[model samples]
Target: MHRSSDTIGAIAAALAKAQGELLNPEKNVIATIRSPFPREESRTFRYASLASGLEIVRKSLGEHEIATVQTTAIDHATGQIQLTTLLAHASGEWISSDWPVCPITETANPHRMGAALTYARRYALFALVGIAGDDDLDAPDLLVEPSPTVQPPEDPHQNRPIPRKSNGSIHKPRQPKPVLSAEPSAVLRDQLVAEIKELNGADDLALWAHRRLPTKNTLTAEDARMVETAYQAAVGPLPGRLDDQVTPLLKTAQKRNKAHLRFVAEQPCLVCQRTPCDAHHVKFAEPRALGRKVSDEFTVPLCRDHHRQLHHHGNEIAWWGNVQIAPLEAAEKLWQETLAAPRPTFRSGVQHHPRPKADERGASSRDSG
Candidate 1:
């Protein structure tokens, strides 16, 4: 949150009074957008449009000598759109908050993106003004009574007994036979050998040849091309690996920005909604070295159990893949927020930061791979 230093006290007092008297915008739009899931049901969603929300906020805050402005900008580094909501008082004091606006659909459809931006702006404005609509895009659909006419598809062979042959043996379906390819030509064999030789030394190539091609009688053209492609991929030019070496002194001097860590710890866990999380260092974000963690900027908010589970998962990159969480992108986004407006470090004697609630703690995720 940003505010004018000279008129902070005045703005605070005015904001508190305005919040007490602010009015919520009416739900003016009822939409029936289809669900992304194929099998799940969809429901009609009611929300206030951006224009309606702005009307309410302007009319309400204007009465209290306050004005508001909302704007959007692109973050060049991540190519993500950010919406900022600013509230200004007549006393020359102001405060604002920035939120990342994300599109639901993957395609670059202008209409869908505009809808996402509108949703974000409406909610951000309402949230800043201390009011909200009946529902929001971020919330899950509320449970409702199921329609009596709608029923699940019935199984055609429910409770049927297994088929048996006349010999009293259970019948089994035949499996498809594997198709074998024709033998590779001598020219293809020579090309494969050359490709392997270029990728590996003679000894390594001989070892691979012995294991994969026991005899030329078994090798096919497909097999030769497959071997050639495998060698190329194994030693080919690729994205930079995080396991590359780094200087010891440079790794040691990596900044442990307490302010960034503290800010990240305040956010809800990426897996669950539990707050007051641990700033988990995503080790794959930077080079791995003996007894060294990645810089603090590469951290994600995770609970104690998830943090511990991540460390013991054996493969950090694969573990993140299973849960569909992009730690590097998330960390970079949060770090960008800090860079836009720096947060102060924690004061002395406040070393023990707030912890998650008792109920929120120790709730291990069953599918946290």
Candidate 2:
């Protein structure tokens, strides 16, 4: 429960933070992020880009120093390229802006790299276009100035005193003018009146209105009428008084065995021994009269497919009762009955024992003679 609460709290906090960032434009700024593949040792190239006011640079460093190269800068507004030669300088090892890098021997601020790249790009452009007044170099075909910022006008209502015209003279006053409350529009008033009339005709609305207005306490006639009308609209005409007919059932099946029902769903099916199973009642008695109580004897587990079959054929109660019987005893009885039944028999032809051999007897007599 504590873990769940913590997770909810974290999610709520994140949503609130995101909403705050969106609503407050001054606090939000666009940023570009770049990082090198730390394990690779190839020659690194410097990259530069603009986003909001944030510029980003990324590069990898090897043992060899980078060489100076001539580069062309494109003018955004004029579609012209200015060429200039510039040296590449290493600014030491890079580190994460938001996290500390303990393993790196040298570390530089992440934000500084972006700033340096932006300045370098601007300087290269200016030099190529001969903006610094180099007489030897010819000016580029097209030159453009950097973009400018535009500021909005201040709001008159913000931190300003209200002006009032008195006796044909305008003057600022220390206190603000009293604000008069506006009346409801004619259309809204007409709509409310129509709803009130509709509600007055309904008995349920009258009861609800009475509850809202409270008969025991003092109430204006207009207020009572409004409440009565609202109640009538909310509840339609009924045979008995609103309170008498709206009584909750004493033994609602939905409430009595909620836990048992959940257990039935979670437990594996007895026949298939697989999840998840359906809970079946053992009797086809009136469902409403059974109430909400769940008992082991009354409930049986069946897989979804089997449960559907039982319901489809109106055999759910009968199947449940069969499962409730002692399954082992039934199986044992079935086995015993199978064994007791007579089976087909076969017999071999009869064999008789022979008397002493005549040859043996003759031999014995001759020996004696």
Candidate 3:
């Protein structure tokens, strides 16, 4: 606090008188901030305009023989902007306070510096006097919000204020705002324009264009190209088209074994549990020569009814898909198990083969001593 050589008794008394008649400044200014970080939800901030706040306090102070002057200067020692508010009484007694000005931008931004100076003057005046606007007292520092119509400098390296805490205090430096280029790609622009012109007067062109364009106004070349790119991606051929091609047959050296087919036939139908089945080959499981049956190792047991149903379906893949069963997987499992089983051993001139009970179509092997 700075004061005149005389004690501040007269000014302090005048300030006390003015405080009783002072009205809380009206919050007349509205600011809408669209932040890009942490998702793009817009927030609305309401604060008193500097002019409105000054009018209210000055009117009250004048009635009580108190005059106030606000001035700005550079603190040479610290190289900081300082706002000094002086309240002088008619008796030569005065009191003043110096407040550090917070710059909106780090660089020497004339426009932002002007805004910062105005912001500092209002807060400092309110503090010197004993009054505040609604919610203004709660804010630890002034918040400099730009008007919507004003475009900021196109500096890519510009810094933005840090987001306020829940209590509205700024404890850290600001972050850099994301910059979007204004100009659109020239090649992309022409291509999009040509395509759009061809669709003129189409029945749904208006609606389609409205939905595609970012806004109703004439779209920039860049925006039009973005829409075209998005549309092509939406209607373009999907990835992994190779999966639709037929899988080539995987050749193996193993010869067909009738005994494996016989074992498969002994099992129940893959679709139904009725016994006395036929070893049905899943032709689609592997590619084969025309009119040649697949190896017995690929045969799965099916009852006479299901076997006929499968042939009627014609598309083996489609039939398996409808039945919600994988005969190819079952066939491979059964063949491997059968091949791994020990050959029948003869004891006392009698043939011995181990037989395990079948759980429906799934086949298992066992050995009997």
Worst 10 residues of 2 by lDDT: 96-105
Model 1 per-residue lDDT tens digits across residues 172-217: 6685544345534555566556656564432344344444453433
lDDT of 3 by residue, 17-89 (tens): 8898898887877877775333346767678888888888888999989889988777543335778899888
Better candidate number, 1 or 2, judged by TM-score: 1
Instruction: Choose the strongest candidate by TM-score.
Output: 1
Model 2 TM: 0.17
| Candidate with the larger TM-score of 2 and 3 | 3
Clashes of each: 0, 5, 1
Q: Estimate each model's TM-score.
A: 0.37, 0.17, 0.35
lDDT of each: 0.64, 0.36, 0.64
Q: How displaced is residue 169 in candidate 3, in Å?
A: 33
Q: Rank the candidates by TM-score, best first.
A: 1, 3, 2
Question: Which tens-of-lDDT digit does each residue in 81-138 have in candidate 2?
Answer: 3334432333321111111111111124446544544455544533322232112224
lDDT score of residue 243 within candidate 2? 31
- Stretch of 10 with least lDDT, candidate 3: 360-369
